[model samples]
Target: MQRRDFAAALTAALAAPAVLGATPAHADERSGGGLSRRMRAALAAELDDQDTARTVVPYLQDIGFDWHPETIAPERLDFIVAYGFGNRPPAGGGDPAKVLPEPGPVNEELADTVARIRRRRTVPVYAQWEIARFLESKYRMKNVTSIEPVIAPDGTITYLSTDGVAAQVAEARKHVPGGIGTAGVVGFRDHVKRCVQTTRDRGMTAYAPRGFEMPGTYDPESGQAWTRRRDLYVVHDMAAQWQVLRQKLIAQAYPNG
Candidate 1:
């Protein structure tokens, strides 16, 4: 899918009733007790339905799980693509000297994975703008490429979306030996599936390493809290799956447009 088309489809998906209706209500319930018992029950039922749909639908099911290789095999891939999680620039923009923003938890995990892979064998790494700078300056990765952001004429910095990133990787792959090679996508466990799928949508082989997922802790003493957190995470991923499905449908409907 073209970047703008995919972005539009994703925006539509974000505004879809299934996402907007559920997410805000859940957030409100968590903050305070405004919802009545009947309303709460209805919301819970809606979430259950979403979960069931995600489980039964083949395409939705495919992008809802993590893919992990059994061991680190740098030889299997010509390069690595590590995705960042919530590395947006600071509001109002601060120091000019701080070009390399600090890595978030997800980027930290990705950097560690890249470091491990580099230790085994040297391979090129591609990353989003902020994390790319972090890897180059902090990790001192010799062969790092930054998937830069799109700056508008008005000076708005728009980070590359998942589809945009995949498109960039497809373009970069043309320069690789034999015009194609395997790519290992590094990111949060819940996010890895979508990353790999989008990369493959661009006609390149992509996989995720076993580790490097966002860490979750279970507390038996507060089991209800844990369940709520887990359900929230699942619902969020379901929304992302919906976005992916919408992008596919848009591409099919407007193949020439």
Candidate 2:
């Protein structure tokens, strides 16, 4: 799809009542099955739209996928929270040390951004899982705390999620004066929205930088290699968004659960 056409579609989609984030009143009418089916049908339609693939490329670029860092006023932030990316252990067992994941490209980028921001003005940074360790050991960042994942006795990570991280941050904020004030949510460009939303759900006002500045003149949607990479990133982002919606529907259906 042409860039202009993609923008139009996106604008229309945003204005639509059935946009991804809106919750229907009857979401739990069928024990969540009603909303689930509706979302599945919407996703099916999105998949069938030929322009979706082409449009997503530009959408990601517009959303700062190429890493145009935002102007962050550190003084406004009470604290910063960095989310983990691809830092989970493998499902199939292997050497524990080898299976332990290090920060991926996204996390590394987040670390670098957070580290730079810290240099300007120091603030407490709470990172999930290995990111906390990475910041402390590699960047030597002080006052960095790790939000550990819940692990079952069988060695499986039971509750390593964005919501889990935000919950921990919310609890910790109780000690901070003014509590849950403005917070910086650091993560990949595409993942930042969900991070900000989850953080807000936990009662913290959150904002994410545009992301690490795209080094030099590299355009993520221009070249063939970059285009393919952006497509994959968009696909993964869409799936992640779907998961968030699914979880929201489940919660609405079973608030006690």
Candidate 3:
């Protein structure tokens, strides 16, 4: 999908009903209770510290969370809701030693997005995988399921989740042509590893997701190269995760895409 489309789709997914312990969309926005107040303070600090508000605001909105500049009156807001959905990072100091856990069960929205991409004749598997990784980073989510890809007899790929059968494949391709190359996997793994090290260097505790692995190129004596999955370190941090994503876009020359 195009970047705009991807962003919009993600926003819609975020706005979906409370999944993964997210606050419900219908909650009272003006409630200045302890949790809401703390969340508001945290959001205000983030908006003030980073120029990424423009990039993150739409994300917050899409996730069924509400936000505004602190200057706005509470009555003026639709609600003072906030969902820590994107990877913009918390502004106030948090335990740098805290490591987020793996995501659990796939919500309907996320499942639908994955299913849509997987069945599209043109969506690259690598890209689909990248999107999945992005979702994990965007929400810092844990306990989510995985999508499995099966190459068809026609050389087409069909994406399936553990929950059910594959949906109808798209008649046309929906994404740029590319598959996971050995080099791409290795490069991504290295990039993520470096980011993890960088976070640790800054005194933050971080780690690769448990059972994390990546596809790597393997050579046989027959002079053929095949891609294989290899275990890799994958630290999860909003800032560091976003850095990796930015690098991917730059590397692929899609800085504005």
Candidate 4:
């Protein structure tokens, strides 16, 4: 799909509440099934892998978690996820059946962290602009005074960077003299954090991994958004992963029903 077309779809998707940090679109519902005991056990094993632990450890730190870094293992993290569609195209030919409805299960610990830092339940309407545009508008709005400010010699303000991530800040400052916000602001981490948290809180259980910068094509006739998805960074083997979880639920009848 053309970049412009995808952008248009993204704009429309963002018109509603955003599920991903970049934009929000309505996701199809997950099947009315729960994870089975054995499937849960397998999922637990996958989540416990060293890579998963490594990925989540930094996330814990980002969210102000106070656990011992070494002791922060994936086994302890909760995988009870909220579901959503990836809004991207799959590898090989894009398959509509393969397109996910929401993000995959996140560690419950992460969800709890988001709840603590949350200022409000929802975010702003214009929160999904491209990073540059967002930062440009933010600097113009002067809402970033609290964080360290970068001003040009001509007194044109450019961008703000938190004390953390000094390298990014310095690189951004390089362009300050040109009156262009040389650096993207450091606040979007919070936006992404909140986006994941909000997605989880909304009861989404699965997610398709797509780059936040990558745009997908939306076919109006088919009513599906298609992205040229490269890899399953979010959940390796999403179909298999979900199938395992789904089979687990399918094997056991509901306790009451």
Candidate 5:
């Protein structure tokens, strides 16, 4: 191989795509289906069904699996999940399949209670309502809130943070600068700091930013929008930690069910 030839080859290789994030198309590069890997990377299910797709996306993301939806033959749906929880966090890792309430025998009284909730719920959608009720009933959920907001045409914004995770507000700020989700911001860390201060002025702490700068992705199963995720430093205190658990109890528990 002449030096000139090698240089050209190297340049060509550089031009080739860097195997995009850990999708099955690149799964062969590693081995094993452990929890640690799943929590850190999104994975494709082996032996999985298309029906499970309805629940698997959120279940996977709840435990930290960053994924892209894959459509395949139904019979190929059977898959295994590696528990993503670690020491001192929760025994089940970052998943509820290992820690959520089991559908043992619901009391006759509690059964009736669920039927009533099925009728008069106040959530944005049906699935969310059902899941919320289950967590509140079985898990003693408290201090739970949703931060979905709309910025009015006059440029005023509606603020929404319940757990005050601190990081979330930062992320939200990055998503739409000046609390505006319009077509004018570059989503940066500094912008997040202002969001926190603003939230504080309005009598609330804040949620930290985790995936503020990414685009939203679709999950084929549940048909919900999930944010393409990045990492952030989060506080491990009660207001934040327990709230995360409460969410898992409902959303992640039978996530793919």
Candidate 6:
């Protein structure tokens, strides 16, 4: 074909829409909301310190429990509300510790604390696991999960729980066309081990969920890896145990949509 005719045909073909056979028609998706369009395309995924109050003194209320996010101190957060779920009760630090043996007394203390706080007016709270999930789903990192005590600024007592799942993309860099590198499982271990040691180093108490094993950090000490249940850690948390009733008790469990 003549050069002009060939060029015209090529241009027409290039402009065609991609249905059965069409090319791209618009600008590529951009990264947003903690996700690169590519990373988000892959799977879809996609914060603290304090130690002022410890000996969280308690008073006794009759039924439910409550505690100020901080003792004799204010907090940046009002309650551990999820950024996305404006109305739903964000998981983590809502009520007292539930898994304790003979929880009645513990529950009593929590109830009493709430009552005392009520006498004051209101209380603030720190949120937990849901935040983690938000991060994971946002980032799309398949190999990371975090479940930690959502301690109030007081630093001593943890009223709510938080959990998050990590997106574990295997060898994502080597696999993802272009990325940092193949630092997936190996890097994951290095971090987890470091985290476990750090958690112990800071003297954070063992808050692993009941029956579920306290996930060991990647122990170079034993020169071994942890058991494979990254999913359990990623997707679950301590607060999964207590039903909403515990939070509501006599009061309604504050319906969540």
lDDT of 4 at 214: 15
Compared with the true structure, all predictions reach lDDT values of: 0.59, 0.60, 0.30, 0.27, 0.29, 0.24
lDDT tens string, model 1, 72-100? 35567778887765543344566423333
The candidate that achieves the highest lDDT relative to the unseen native structure: 2
Error of 4 at 231 (Å): 3.9
- Of candidate 3, the 10-residue stretch with the lowest lDDT total is 77-86
Task: Tell me the tens digit of each residue's lDDT in model 6 across 29-83.
Answer: 1112111122222221110111211111111100011111111121211211111
Model 1 residue pairs with clashes? none
Please give the ranking of all candidate structures by lDDT, highest first, separated by commas. Answer: 2, 1, 3, 5, 4, 6
TM-score, candidate number 1 = 0.61
Local accuracy of candidate 2 as per-residue lDDT tens digits, 176-225: 87656778877655556667777887887887643344112212432223
TM-score for each predicted model, relative to the true structure: 0.61, 0.58, 0.20, 0.19, 0.18, 0.16
- Model 2: how large is the Cα RMSD against the reference? 11.6
Taking all chains together, the TM-score of candidate 3 against the true structure is 0.20
Query: At residue 150, what lDDT does model 4 achieve?
Result: 46
The clash count for each model shown is: 0, 1, 14, 26, 24, 31
- What CA RMSD would candidate 1 show? 13.1
User: Model 1 — which ten-residue stretch has the worst lDDT?
Assistant: 218-227
Candidate 2 vs 5: which has more lDDT: 2
The residue-by-residue lDDT of candidate 3 on 28-122, one tens digit each, is 23233333333333444544633454445433442224311112212221111100111211235353233221211222233233333233322
Off by over 4 Å in 3: 1-23, 28-40, 54-58, 64-158, 161-257
Evaluated against the true structure, the overall lDDT of model 4 is 0.27
Off by over 4 Å in 5: 1-21, 24-30, 35-62, 65-157, 161-245, 248-257
Q: TM-score: which is higher, 1 or 2?
A: 1
Lowest-sum lDDT 10-residue window in model 6: 55-64
Candidate 4 residue 82 C-alpha distance from true site, Å:
21
Model 4 alpha-carbon drift over 4 Å, by segment: 1-33, 41-139, 145-230, 235-257
lDDT tens digits, residues 12-128, model 5? 322332443354323323334333233222222331444454445344433222222222222221110000001122334444323322322212122233223323332111111
TM-score comparison, 1 vs 5, better candidate: 1
